[model samples]
Target: MLYKRGKTWWVDFVDASGQRVRRSAGTTDKAAAQELHDQLKAEAWRQSRLKESPARTWDEAALRWLDEKAYKASLKDDMQQLEWLHSFLSGMKLPDQDCRASPCL
Candidate 1:
């Protein structure tokens, strides 16, 4: 299902794990949001069936990586590298940022 909040479109749907997932479609247009929702549903189904990872933004993945390393002994070294990477990578969407490679294809 699609809804709007402050010019942004959001979707709420049951995932393959029977978990309710709500995510922003990243657009204000209803048609585009619906299309994104449809794609998200399909991706969820595919990930559930094939045990693949879903789509992710670079920031999302990077933050996750940082979180995982929060307790590491070499966290400082990791942070230095992560900072450099963050600076190098612009905000553009990465086509292969997800854990699964080319799952959309």
Candidate 2:
């Protein structure tokens, strides 16, 4: 969650269910705060994988890439492109696209 502590802005991890757990290493600069954000995301992901698969589909990978790069100057336009791309590919077969497959029973 994003919070302001004194003169610094922090984006640390708060447990979704627990609501009281906090993982914060205070940072006074934007770059450091961002680095901490990445570290927290990584840690959360690692923890989550213990309960479920870490494997992701192509669609999820694309979405993750978009999220990671969304702070860039081209973010708005990139989002537009993503919307268009998703729409265009909605019902199309993507056998070569490296997506998750459902095996025949």
TM-score of each: 0.60, 0.35
In model 1, the Cα lDDT at residue 3 comes to: 89
Query: Judged by TM-score, which candidate is best?
Result: 1
Consecutive 10-residue window with the lowest summed lDDT within model 1: 90-99
Runs in model 1 lying further than 4 Å from the true structure: 55-78, 90-105
User: What tens digits encode model 1's per-residue C-alpha lDDT throughout 57-79?
Assistant: 66776888888879999999988
**Model 1 pairs in collision:** none
The residue pairs that clash in candidate 2, if any, are none
Q: So what's the TM-score on candidate 2?
A: 0.35
